[model samples]
Target chain A: MSGALLADAPGVLAALAQGASAVLLGLGLLFWFAGSWPLLGRASYLTKLHYLGISDTLGSALMLLGLLLRFQREWPLLVLALLSLVVWNTIFGYVLAACSQPRRRP
Target chain B: MSRLIVIALRMLIWLLLSADPELLNVAIGLAVSLALPLPRRVRALSPGQFWRALGESVTALPQAYSQAARLLLHRRLEESVVHDEPARVGGRASSVLVFLDVFRITLTPFTIALGLEGGGRRYRVHELVFEEKER
Candidate 1:
């Protein structure tokens, strides 16, 4: 095969990976922006929960995924563990917040 | 000799956790030396007191270790919530627990920003509040 043919496969793969990373980055950015907007107004307790929960979990997950993709390592097991820990940490925050709050009567 | 052993062990643990081992060793050694417990005859303390202290510390150690590990590993709180009740205290942020020993207060990432030992005791903390109410 000619040199041009040899390079085409890798170039297309790189472009595809870049496109995927951009999408992931944009999604994470959107989550973060939406979650933080409530700080400007009189934010309620529920609002605060919404802000922290979505941003903390989904945004962080997306960000971590993007980072892993960028690294493009073959260590699948390590990556899975890292992602799980990040998600767990995010959920744990929500749990702590919930436990700290006083229960309301029906 | 026995007293010296106890002091030395305590110093070792402090050193392991501390950033400046030399400074902590000096400080702890000085404090222990200055505040050495009275002789067994002079103090006439009951043996039960020693056992009680040992038991309490033994129970507290695992908890302190887990809390410290969580801090080091960046483990987030499992549950945290904010509810506005009739303000028993004036400000939203009031009543900080310092040196409570409940959750390994010493080695936590949050350090006491300011403390006042007036009527009782008061502390101001500068911690990264993952969640806090604005008002």
Candidate 2:
């Protein structure tokens, strides 16, 4: 029993990591799809934007995290990508909202 | 000085994305970074304000998630208009503040900024769930 445990320890750890990565990826896709599903409804554009933007941001972050875990050696790039995703998404959302508003005459 | 810093930071990001530390790659990254134009006004946030905003955002995350979850579980969609007053006088500073406000509010799934109203002094938000007292 002890010999078997020692032999399989590395395999067990690898399997665990793989499982975790899969779970995170699944969750990310779920968030993305669920958020987008609301867009088809009768809600207004702003409402749809709320659901889509927030979910897309969170989804991308989660997907990146999953990839980060899977590719632990490339974490610096993944972390930077995640940061850019969140920052740019929020900024773009603001831009879209600001642009959608009717311009007031001076 | 800040513009140089910005360019340097952009170069660093470019290098990271490229993942090639070769001389040619670095030169190209530097050139590209330098070519990007800087904004007319750079209102640098003081460390204190940055820290405060970071803290507030950290605390706000859970609330945002809970609200999103509630919205997801509920079948009915209710729309309501809400007004937000700018904390500063209207100008570039106020515009930056408004942008930040929109980002913060839209981070949550329940609310979106519909438009700026009342000469950009107020924001009109469309909320998924609105309470009477909030109006």
Largest TM-score belongs to which candidate?
2
Q: Candidate 1, residues A39-73: lDDT per residue as tens digits?
A: 46665444354455445545555666666566675
Estimate, for each residue in B1-135, the C-alpha lDDT of model 1 and write its tens digit: 334434654554444444354766669755865476733423222345444434553465344333323333443433333222221122221122221221222222222122222322332222333322122
Fnat, one value per model: 0.00, 0.46
Residue pairs whose backbone atoms clash in candidate 2: none
DockQ score of the complex predicted as candidate 2: 0.47
Q: In model 1, what is the error at residue A86, expressed in angstroms?
A: 4.4
Q: In candidate 2, what are the lDDT values of residues B1-135, reduced to their tens digit?
A: 346556877987887788888999999998888788876777554445444555665665566666666666665665555556453435434333455566666676666666666665666665666432233
Clashes of each: 9, 0
Q: What is the TM-score of chain B in candidate 2?
A: 0.60
How well does candidate 2 score on lDDT at residue A41? 89
Give residue A93's lDDT in candidate 2 (0 to 100): 72
Which stretches in model 2 have alpha-carbon errors above 4 Å? A1-13, B1-12, B18-37, B58-63, B88-99, B114-122, B130-135
Q: What is the TM-score of chain A alone in each candidate?
A: 0.69, 0.82
- For every candidate in turn, the CA RMSD to the true structure comes to 16.5, 4.4
Query: Lowest-lDDT window of 10 residues in candidate 1 chain B?
Result: B93-102
lDDT for residue B22 in candidate 2, whole number 0-100: 94
